[model samples]
Target chain A: MDHHLILRVVTRLLVAPILLFGLYVQFHGDFGPGGGFQAGVIFAVALILYGIVFGLSRLRSIFPDRWVMRLLAFGLLLYAGVGVVSLIQGGNYLDYNVLLPSAKAGQHYGIIVIELGVGITVFGVMMAIYYGFAGRPPSIEDTDW
Target chain B: MTDLAVTLLLFFALVSTAIAIALLRSLFAVVMLSGVFSLLAALLFIAMDAVDVAFTEAAVGAGISSVLMLGTIALTARHEMKPKRWSATPLIIVGIIGAFLIYGTLDMPAFGDPNAPVQTYLNPDFIARTPKEIDVPNIVTAVLASYRGFDTMGEVAVVFVAGLGVTMLIGGSGGFLRRRYRETVLSRKDGQA
Candidate 1:
């Protein structure tokens, strides 16, 4: 195969592994060093490499800049909103115990929800960042490429 | 003996990788090699038994940062031609500092003895009682989202500020730029259709 084909093939092969690794880290973050932020970045890298090989425009056709932006905003809102809600629930700021009515369950639920939010936001932001750089001037088309 | 051997190997791997990163000329190569540095640092962290930190450093510093740098390169520049006048003085100074850091290692506690300064003074009371009091499995989590929660709050606020700043800097000017882009993208779609 030609060099371009070789590059394409290698990149394709790498994408799945990177994404799987990202997910592994994300869910396993509780006991280990992996967490939402780190996993999100890992997830973003796979998309970025995909964007690179398939051309920015082609990548945009699938993910789109607008949805990515909305997702980014949504993640941040989810995180902040959770913090405020926890505060209002009678726990201190970001106090997970107050997140739910119960104590331990609240803590567990709070961490899960918040981290998941962070992961979503981080993932979206990472992609938005990539989209900003990769598909700076995004189209309004929501079609599948 | 095995542990010492592992630590020493990690040290050498880290040093050699750092040196290679410094010596590399190409930007892409530099990014990739710096990733090697992150990976080596991760291994060193593991050797020291800081499993959580090792995982983070390996995943983010080595993985995400490398990819981000690569993307920035793609968006910006790729191959870097050698500078016309590369100086050796800065390199010498950096080398000396790095050597000093290595030299300073002589004073550091031996690896993972549990009686080491860090382990001993780790506020064993808190480490011991936190799980019972907080009911969280991850001690780090208890410390992060609860015990040191105010700090986390401050951090979240800072993050909010940064997000705010980015929005402003990127032209959140009453959403005019967004509207304009929407129109352009729509018009393009209509034209293409």
Candidate 2:
């Protein structure tokens, strides 16, 4: 993989743009088609591409397994925390209307907050799954295919 | 109409792809064809005006699942094993299930019917009130993140648990617990012996 000049070069060129598109999808989801789920998967795709071309060890160095586990838990916590905050604010659970001075503003803020949580959790989980699959000891070699 | 023609063509392609998948013996080719099937389904979704669902099917189904399958093949055999004998049991079961499903669909409302239960339910209110309530242009987003926030939260938690399960099963740390448990059991047996 390291000797494949074209693949390495193309991957290097594509990684940054893929990550940028994932962010665009994540933030623009409110106004458009994409949301946290799509964006999270897209973001994970970029990292997985790097792992496929550059090797899993390199991907692990960049994003350690420990952090992946933490982020996985963190995303769900953020989502539940938002609900708790709303509950404490004298509104029904997950009622974004009470989060701010205005109902619309509160809805806007709450949606963004929860969407971020979804994105983070999805991204972490996807990468973790990829690591689980690719990190195993191979019974068959690359040339076997 | 062009939409109808394209939709029909895509459905035809989907059926063929599914049959091909069933007939193919090579696991690698099956995985590739499944990716193609997902892409076709995504096109169908787009034609039906469901761009968000289309994006997800294309990304997760075509992109990630294909890669994951390839990784799985690398870990195992490339070709599927031949069955020992031909059997009608599976075919009969499938036919019975398919008949029941088709029978069930006979009572369902037609696509985009104004009086359909879905349209008559909360959809009208969501569409009518989302502008002032959520202030978002996308009603889907308003409904998913605002009106049904608890459901989305639950989905997120499900994803979290899935990740945890994968970590416990296949991630490197889980092996430590297995080794420790094995050691404890062996020591107890040794004491008994």
Candidate 3:
């Protein structure tokens, strides 16, 4: 895989921009055609592209399995935690009105935070799934392709 | 109209790609064709003005899933083995299911009909109130995260659980973790010597 100099160079150039786009989608979701799900998958695609071009071992070193597992839980907890905070604030579960002084402000803040949670979980899950599949020994060599 | 023409063309392409994927024995080709199918569907969604759905279909469906399928092929067989006997029963079952699905759609309203039950009911309320209530430009995000927060939380939970399942199956003990642990141990022992 390393012998393909062109592939490696192109991947290096593209990965940062791809990740930046994912963040843009994640944050700009309220105003645009993206949210946690799309942004998360896009972010995962960056890592997956890097993994494919370089190798799984290099990918794992950077995105350790332990962090992936923890973040997977962290995102879900963050989502639920938001709901609980709303409940504790004397609003219904997940009611964002109480999260801030103004109802609109709360809605804006709540949506952004929850979407971030969604983004994280999605990114983690996707990368985990890719790792799961690619970590298995390949039956055929690269030359076979 | 141009929109109709574009949609019909994309739909025809989608159908052809689906059939091609069904007919192809090569798993790799099937995966690639599925990605093409996702792209076509994404284009169709854009034509219908559902930009959010289009974005998701393009990114996850065409992008990540295709790559994942290729990774799967790397692990497993590239070509699907032909069944010893081509059975008519499975074909008959599929035909019956397809017939029922088509029949189900027959009762549904035409695409984008303003009077459609879906467009008439709760949607109007959301649209009218979203600006003042949520103050967000994208009603989809507002409804998904705040108005219908529980459902979205459930969806996130489902993804979390799915990741857990896959990690259990492929990340623990007999998987990458144990193997990496052994390598580290061996390296540490050699370093100490």
For each candidate, what's the DockQ? 0.28, 0.68, 0.65
List, residue by residue over A98-139, the lDDT tens digit for candidate 1: 766677777666666666666666677666555544344432
What would the TM-score be for candidate 2 when compared with the true structure? 0.92
Candidate whose TM-score is highest: 2
Instruction: Identify the superior model by DockQ, candidate 1 or candidate 3.
Output: 3
Tens-place lDDT per residue, model 2, B59-131, is 9999889988988998788999999999999999999999999999999998778999999999999999999
State which candidate has the highest DockQ: 2
Across residues B3-97, which tens digit of lDDT does each residue of candidate 1 receive?
88998998898889877876777777889889999998988888877777887788678876776676567556556777789789988998899
TM-score of chain A of each: 0.79, 0.96, 0.97
Report lDDT (Cα) of residue B155, candidate 1.
51
CA shift of B144, model 3, Å: 0.4
Q: Could you tell me which 10 consecutive residues in candidate 3 chain A have the lowest summed lDDT?
A: A136-145
Backbone clash pairs in model 3 (N, Cα, C under 3 Å; residues 3+ apart or in different chains), count = 0
Candidate 2's docking class is medium
- Please give the lDDT score at residue A79 for candidate 2: 88
Candidate 3 per-residue C-alpha lDDT over A1-145 given as tens digits, one digit per residue, 9 for 90 to 100: 8788999999999999999999999999999889999999999999989998988778888987778888898999998999999999999988999999998899999999999999999999998788778877663366655
lDDT winner, 1 or 2: 2
Candidate 1's C-alpha runs over 4 A off are A1-24, A136-145, B85-88, B99-123, B153-193
The TM-score of predicted model 3 comes to 0.91
Models 1 onward score TM values of: 0.76, 0.92, 0.91
